[model samples]
Structures are given as C-alpha cells and as structure tokens.
Target: MDKSVSKSSQPSGGNGFPTSSSNGRKLNKKLVYLCSIVMAVLFFLGIAAFVFLFLLHKNPKATNKNIASFRVDSIFVSRFKLSSSKITASWDIRLSVQNPSTASVSYQTFYTWIQYKQERLSNVTNIAPFQVRGNNWTAENGKLVAKSVRADEKVIEDMATEMANGSVNFNIGLYAGFWIGNEEAKRVWRAVEAHCSDLKIGFSSKDNMGKLIGEPIECILTKTW
Candidate 1:
C-alpha cells in the first residue's frame, strides 16, 4: 500500500527564520521604546524648569531684601544758575550703599544726574568704579558739574520760582551695574536704578550756595535684569 505525503508548515523565510510580519513587529517595538525614552527626558526637563520659576515667584520679598539699598545723605550746591537758554551747577552729593548679599559686590557704569521737576538739567556723569564688602555699607562722594547745559523753559521757570521762595526741590538719580562675587570670582550681574526725590535745598537771597535740609532721603530702588 502507498502512504500519503504532507507539505511542511514552517515559515517561508530563509533558513527557517522568522517571517516578514514577525520582523516588522520587532522593529515597531524598538521604535516605541525609543519614542518613550525621548518623551521621558523631555518631561523631566519641563518639570525642572517649572520648579525653578515657581521658586522665583514665591520668594519676591527675599529677593528684594538680598539685593541692596541706596540713600542720599546730603547735598551741597556751590553754584547753581539757570536761564531759559542755559544752566550751570556744581553739586557735592554724599550717598551710602548697603549690600545685603553674602558675596562682595562691585559696581560699575555708575551714572548720576540732576533733575528739576520732570526736566533733566544736567549731563549724566560717570562715577568711578567702587566695591562694597558683603553685608556692609560704603560711602560714595559724587561731584556733579553742569556747565552751559541747555535748559527748557518750564524747567527754568519752575527753578527760578522755587529759588525765589528760598528753597528748591530737585531729584538726584543714579544708575549702576552690580556684580555679586569676590575679586577672584564673579557669579551674577544686575542693574539698579535709584531716585532720591524731593531734595529740599535752602538758598539765601540770590546766592548760589545751598545746603540740604530735613532728613536723609532713602532712594527708591528698582532692579533690572
């Protein structure tokens, strides 16, 4: 009697290897794992950024306290004359700066100016670079000179009226960049703007000399990036 023969049930791939469908499934799995790894890395980075911003938002008062403070101790005007066309003045400004940071602070790009009402009457003079120790105060004596500076009509009128009444109010403005670090290292840099307004200086008769009155004025401070 003759026996019946049956065909082989193995895959068609060479050397009895896995079929094309099985190879496709393995490649798909690899792609999935790669995508998952990339997404996980991105997610952690995003979380880190959010945490940093949240901490900054929650500690505004601490940030302000750690920056610094500025105060105008006194001002002496030796010569101040103004007209509609021109202005001239010599000012000796005594000021103090307090650094609350733990690191030493150095200041540069120091600028000082004088303003009458809202009108500026002098050029912005550059002060010498200086440094203040950590958690300490430093006194800076600044001399501002304005010679033949063009004056606005409103500024001259207001200044003359105030001088005639025995006292004139002017605003002293200062700006500088502060670096927080020791002499051997630098960590961060910041810009600060300080305005000491309502500076009442008393003058007698038509004399150009004047002295600051009342208490020392603490300047309003603003920080820039």
Candidate 2:
C-alpha cells in the first residue's frame, strides 16, 4: 500500500504566510475610514477660524465703534481756595454720553485735571465706572475735589489779574478706558481722552477769598481715542 500525506485547508498569501480573518480585515478598513473623516473635519474647521480672524482684524471699527459721543453738559464750582503757594477747587460736573452702536459701552476709573495756561492746577481720580445702553443717551454725574496746585510767582500774578478781571480761563482734561459690548458678546477695551479748552470760571472777591460769581461756563470739548 502507498502512504499519502494530506495538507491543511487554511488560506495563504503569495509569500506563503497565513492570511488574517475576514472579520479582522473588515475592522481595519473601518478604522482607516473613520480616521480620514476626522482629519477632514479638523482641516475645514481650522480654515474657517483663520478666515474669521482675518476679517475681524481688517474691520476693527465694526467690532468697536468709536466713542466720540461724549460731551461736557455742565459744570458747577461749589468751593474755591486760593493761597500764595497752591490753589484748590471742588466742583460737580455732568457728562452726556451716547452709544451710537448697537452694543453697550462701559468705562471704569475716570480722572479729570484742571489746567491754567498749560499749567496743571489740580486733579481728581478714582471715580466710579459708567455704562450706557445701545443707541441711547445717559447722564453721568461726578464730584471732583482737586488737590492743591503749587504755583510760581508768574502763575500767581496771572491768577490775580484774571480774578480782578472777574473771569479766569482754564482747561479741563479727562481720561478713561472704555469697553464695547456686554458679557455675552466679544469685548474690546480702548483708551479715550477729552480736552475742554477755554473754560471761563467767573468769581468775585469777598473778604480776601474767591467766591463763585455764577454757573460754570461751557467750553469747547474735543475727544480722541
């Protein structure tokens, strides 16, 4: 009788290596497909973000409207103190602020300084912040007590002459920071400056002390961002 050997039925590749199961091949194909989809989505998202940021940078004014709608409505000098070395004044001022944009605006820590002939006389700081609604006007009131302003001989002389003339010309400087939009929307912060020129303060001399003659005079106001 002749002896015959039988071979197994397992599948093999060209290299004669055992092939993977059909289920395992299917699972590998699914994983590769899923990875490709995820990569495509991420690439599209990155491109969209880049375009948005580019547009935002190009049109900054659209994001933050200029805060030019600020003005000095009125001012009232309640007390005045003049001395040989320094001068001090206290006053209440009212401001009219308008938000022209559709978004709200807010500011913190207001400061004001009184100047005469380009000389800094006094300054007040640390006032409270204010907020204005969209496309609306609001009145903000604050009191300022200026610190003692040291003066030289020429300044004192000019002050005396102006007091004798019954009107003193002064300048007022204002500074603050403003933020656009509310908490829900993106916010932008900017610095603002205001200058009121030729503010004429009228006073009368009584018993060697200066007394306010009438309401504070309105002055030319200019603003910069």
Candidate whose lDDT is highest = 1
lDDT of 2 by residue, 1-225 (tens): 123222333344435565667668989999999999999999999999999988765544364345546666666665576778787787666767767666677876567776778778776555689888887988777676666778776887888788788777776677777787787457877666777776666665653333233454333335445
Index of the highest-TM-score prediction: 1
Error of 1 at 184 (Å): 4.9
At residue 80, what lDDT does model 2 achieve? 72
Every model's TM-score: 0.69, 0.61
Clashing pairs in 2: none
Clashes of each: 0, 0
After TM-score superposition, the amount by which residue 192's alpha carbon in candidate 2 deviates from its true location, in angstroms, is 1.0
The ten-residue window of minimal lDDT in model 1 covers 1-10
Clash count, predicted structure 1: 0
Give me the runs in candidate 2 sitting further than 4 Å from their true place.
1-60, 63-65, 207-225
Off by over 4 Å in 1: 1-65, 183-186
